[model samples]
Target: MVYREMETDAEMAMFVKCFWMSDSQNDEGIHTVLPDGYFDLIFYRIDNNLNRIFLTGTWTIPVDVPFTKNTSHFGIRFKLIASEYIFRESIERIIDTSTNLPLHYWNVSDETFENLETFSIEMGRIIERFIPDYTEIDRRKFSLMGCLYDNHGDISVAELSERVGWSSRQINRWFNNQFGLPLKTFANILKCHHAYRQIAQGRFIPESAYYDQAHFIKEIKRYTGYTPKELFELKNDRFLQLSTHDNG
Candidate 1:
């Protein structure tokens, strides 16, 4: 198994976290995928032929994926704010689902779709053509997201509402409309991600974001479907480990 990733171009850095590709010639069996609070546009291939192109939605629970030998995959990991530009409808409609990207979704040419190697090389240009102009983004909401991220999701809804000059209800409405989850849920996912990194690094201190040991365990289980000990003991979860490292 080989996994490679590159940071998004400067122009797209605000919306995209990174672009990644993975190739594996060995049978990896079933891999567990944990919730990471973001969505991805994924391209899959086997034996160098296009297999699928789809958009994965935000997830609140773990998912299992089976990997066969000689598989290759490429993907764009989008920041939460990019939901408006990537999806045609309310994100709430696609939570915990994978929707095939129709022709109209990206308006990409068939030639581009058929030739993934070339497409991967020119991904930045292809993405730029489909991405909405940066000026069109809602700066207020973007800033609010930044505040949450900067605080590692430890900020309260009331504090977020005050900072954004929106009521808690309005903030949650926006969160649901854009990311398919409430503000509190999204924050919890973010908190879990932070805990995941700590655990991955072999440091499992109780962080400020967690109310107590029980709360930490609950959030970990909610996102990963495993307790901290179980997840750490998992030896067949290479995909999950790789994904977590790339996200970090």
Candidate 2:
């Protein structure tokens, strides 16, 4: 397994988290992908030619992906708000699904798509052509999202309402319309991601985010479908480990 990640350039950082690629020839069997409140554009190839292009939407549960021999994957991990710029359709249509991408949806020239070498470089070009100017984005919403991220999804709805000067109902409606989930659900996903990072690093503390040990275990299980111990003890968990490292 050769897994690596590169930070997005300044221009693309507003909507993209990073560019990641993996080349694994081993028979690692089934690898589970955990929910992390983000979307991904994945390109998989078996022997250098594109085998499939998938656009994955936000997930609230774990997904299992089977590894194949001599397969390589390149992906663009998009930020939470990226769907607003990348897709014209409602996000609710794609939640928890990996939809195949039509060639027309790529918004790139056929020659450019065929010549895709480095995903990071090619993604930058695609984003440059499709995304609107950054200044056009809602700065207030972006700032509120930053606050939520900085706190690792620990903030309350009332507090967020006050901070954003919007009613809780309004915020929930907007989030549902754009993200296909309520604000609280999105926050819980982020919290789970944060907790997973702590667990992956062997530094989890019960009191860090939960009321009690039982609550911690239940929440972890709710998001990941596995107890912390089982998740940690799994040996063929390269995808889980990579998601934790990259998303953290």
Candidate 3:
């Protein structure tokens, strides 16, 4: 597989995490997707054929994604706030799964995937135009997302509420309604995801994001269905994100 990723600029940073593309290179196999606390809008093709689009909701657990020969995927990984400010729809119903979108959803098409560089620019323009015109940005929710991602979800719910000036109940209520999970669970997924990068680099011991080794191991297994050791092996490229750690 050939995977490439591009982080968004400061202007779009609040909404988009990155734009990524992957080609299976004629190798057909299954890749395990571990939750990284972000949702994605993906455009892909198999056997170099028709362009297909899908929107994925926040994941609470691992999911197996199978790809066929000549498959290429292009996607925008979005921050939690995008659900309200960009997509403007509740993703609660699609949690742990994906929903198909129209072929030209957001005016994205097969031609957009012709060049990765152009794709990035075009998508950024789309987001730039849409968010400012159609959506009302919420400062509290935006700040909350920034804190969560910046801290790698290491902070407690109480602390987050205090910092963002939002009540714990309201924050979690928003999380469940928009992302289909509680704030703590999403935070744990983010924490575990950062730990996943460390584990991929052959570091297994618990870091600051975890309370201890036991807690670290439990969280890793909870989201990934693998212990740190297993993830380190990256057996058969099972953990897709780990495999792309270098590129990421």
lDDT of each structure?
A: 0.73, 0.74, 0.86
- Residue-pair clashes per candidate: 0, 0, 0
Per-residue error (Å), model 2, residue 144: 2.7
lDDT of 3 at 12: 90
What tens-digit string does per-residue lDDT give for candidate 1 at 54-153?
8888878888877889887778887777777644456677789888865344554445533335555467776677677668766677778888777778
The residue pairs in collision within model 3 are none
lDDT of 3 by residue, 119-200 (tens): 8988998988767543456778888999999999999888888988999999999999998999999989999888877787
Error of 1 at 2 (Å): 2.3
| Candidate 2, 104-195: lDDT as tens digits | 55654423333335567877887877777778787667766776777778899889888878888988887888878989888888888777
User: Which regions of candidate 1 deviate over 4 angstroms?
Assistant: 86-88, 102-121, 235-239, 242-248
TM-score of each: 0.86, 0.87, 0.95
Candidate 3 regions with alpha-carbon error over 4 angstroms: 133-135, 246-248
Error of 2 at 47 (Å): 1.3
